[model samples]
Target: MEAYCSMKAQEVRKLIREQVITGQTSGMATGFTQANLVILKQEHALDFLLFCQRNPKSCPLLDVTEPGSYRPAKLAEGADIRSELPSYRIYRDGVLAEEVNDITDYWEDDMVGFLIGCSFTFEAPLLAGGIPIRHIEENRNVPMYKTNIACTKSGIFEGPTVVSMRPMKAQDAIRAIQITTRFPDVHGAPIHLGDPSLIGIDDVSAPDFGDAVTINEGEIPVFWACGVTPQAVAMQSKPSIMITHSPGCMFISDRKDSELSVL
Candidate 1:
């Protein structure tokens, strides 16, 4: 696992497709872009694309696949979305059906996959800027929450925005905000900082997804619009079927981190 941290994006995707790696991708494939997956039938693609456009902060569009195509031509070369991700979540009629290592059984001719930018991409820059990522330091997945702030609706997709949280002291939080703002494709900057309740999170220690890390005495929780927002929003619409990357599990893209930076 430690060695995988230094692996290139393509190498990491190869390992994932072979089922040799099946966990969160927070620190792996450093300096590469990691994406959130959302696959739906062609019937829902347009509306979902509109939903994404309406909620750019939460669902920054990275790439999209043609109907029935698993290859993400723009983000990765020769990458099969069905088998390249570490894990996939299958949703049926607004409910989580199951999680699988591969989506071959569920792949349909009319399905379209949407790749959304993930906050994980900015973690590398944050570290370079001297902002420590607590989850990476503690060897745990970064905590994510389902917030009370409702996302703008488009067609059937409508729900509260989900957010990823990192607790940091006032100064670090401010620096993190600046560091992350340079990458608009990867959520840019935090949507909220300080109280978790302001976003409707009842407990900071207990997250809706991923593992919780200890928050130091002076650190306050910083919240960023999360890629998982689409998954949560899509589920609310209760489409006949939907698919997404399991929380923390991501699709490694060939694109470099520098490509996503605004500066």
Candidate 2:
């Protein structure tokens, strides 16, 4: 993992494309910006863009591709969105139909890919601030749960928000909020901390997506709006089709994390 942590974004993407890295991208290509992918037909692009606009906390825009183009010119030039991520999820009529390592076969000329800001992009800064990220330490995907918080409606896209969790001591969580607030492009700061029940999460031990980690005796679970919210929206909006990165398996971009920092 240390070897992967030191790799350049392009190198990490190469390995992912070649099926060398087939898991969550939490600690890989450290310091580079990571993004969540959502691909849809041109007809649905406008509505989805509005959806993102209305729900910036959960779907902050990073780089969006032109119709029929797979390369995200602003994020990772020349990189193929169809196969760059370690895993891809295909939704048919809002239901997850399949999971694959490559989406080349499903690509359409009218497809537009939206790369949303990922919380993983801010994880490095959190670690640098001495805030230990439990998922990275436990070598597991960050736990994500559907929240009662409803997103603003945008066309057919409307659903409860989803959030990623990281258990931290009170002091570390405070520092995390301070550090992450500098990167709003990514889901910045903790939306909720302490009790999971307040956010409609009935069980912290079993998450809606990803793996749960240890929430030590003195630590509280901190939650941040997650890029995975789109998946939940997809289930409700029932789009004809949607393609997204599997939860926690993100696209590693060439952009540096500092590039998105406001401070």
Candidate 3:
């Protein structure tokens, strides 16, 4: 079975290239640094680059492709951005127009690619700390929502930061904060906890992306700034064109999860 194989991240990337897999990448490339992808035309690269810098929590830049280039120079070699991802979202002037498994048809000489750190990279550490993540236990993607919290605006990109939620007992929640603080590269530490309404989240059951899992009694909902914030902001920013990995579908980086350890 695919789950039984202790495969390397590179091997998993090969499968994505073959199109044998077509679904969210969450929990798949375990121990590898999974990242959120963003692509935009070169004309907006300066503004967008500044935007990411201003909103580091939501858009921690990883590796970026040069203008008009597809091959990622430092992240992955021989990696095809247009086909490696299981799915892609195409936005025109900042509106969702289509979702596809590949984007070779959408590639242009003026486009640039960006990789952002994802919370999935922290799942391993949380598990190691004995803090259970409900979504993984339920075999569903993590729940995400757009919050009322606004990120620092950069250039033409300015929008509320989105976040992913996980419920935990009070004591475990405290320990989780300590454990996750070490992994800032991936989302480090919970931003808000306890009441969702404090962050403008009305209903925890209705998630913006991914499926919701059971929240036990006495558990508090903890929120973390999400990589999706950038994508959602791009949707509202209405850039001439934008592309990003589908929700839960991320680019598997060659770096080891421990390589991301801030020690």
Candidate 4:
């Protein structure tokens, strides 16, 4: 894990493309930015772009690929979006059809890929600030849940907002808010803190996506809008087809985390 944390983004991406690394990417490629992927046909691209524009917090744009091009020019150079990510989820008519290590078979000439900012980009700063990320400590994926809070609809895109949670003490939570606020592209700041029930989470121990972690006494759960929100939207919107990174498995980009930070 330590070796992976110190590796360059391109090295990590190479391993992933070869299917050597096929799991969550939380602590890998420490200082680089990571992104969530969303692929749709050219016809649906405009509507989805509008969807992302309206829900900036959950779907902040990182770099979008040109139609028929698998390369994310702005985020990664000489990297193929079709296979660079560890894992992918294929959706057909809004229903998840299959999970694959590569999407080359599904790629279309008119397909447009959208790279959304991922919260993993901000985890390094949180750790540097002395905040212990329980999921990282436990070697598990960060827990994510679907909230009752509805996202602003754009075209056929409409669904409940999704969020990822981290447990920390009150002081650490406050510090995290300040540190993360600098990176709005990466789902900056906690949208909700304390009780999960307030956000329609029935049980914090059972998350809608990813793995659950220990929440110590006196520690509160901090919720941040998640890039996975698009997955939920895909289910609701029922597009003809969509492809995305599986929950927690992200595309490691050449861009540095600091590049996305406002500070």
**Candidate 2 deviant stretches above 4 angstroms:** none
What local distance difference test score does each model get?
0.91, 0.92, 0.86, 0.92
Candidate 1 residue 150 Cα shift, in angstroms, is 0.5
- Candidate 1 C-alpha lDDT tens digits along 104-140: 9899999999999998889888888888889989988
Put the candidates in lDDT order, highest first: 4, 2, 1, 3
Angstrom error at residue 13, model 4: 1.8
Q: How far is candidate 4 from the true structure (C-alpha RMSD, Å)?
A: 1.3
Least accurate 10 contiguous residues by lDDT in model 4: 23-32
Report residue 170 deviation for candidate 3 (angstroms).
1.1
Task: Record all residue pairs in model 1 with backbone atoms less than 3 Å apart, i.e. clashing.
Answer: none
Collision pairs in model 4 = none
lDDT of 4: 0.92
69-114: candidate 4 lDDT, tens digit per residue? 9999999977999999999999999899999999999899999999
Local accuracy of candidate 2 as per-residue lDDT tens digits, 1-263: 77999999999999999999988887788889899999999999999999999999999999999889999999989999999999999999999999999999999999999999998788888888888888888878889999999999888899999999999999998899999999999988778999899989999999989898999999989999999999899999999999999887899999999999999
Error of 1 at 24 (Å): 2.3
Q: What are the models' TM-scores?
A: 0.96, 0.95, 0.95, 0.96
lDDT-better candidate, 2 vs 3: 2
Runs in model 1 deviating more than 4 A are none
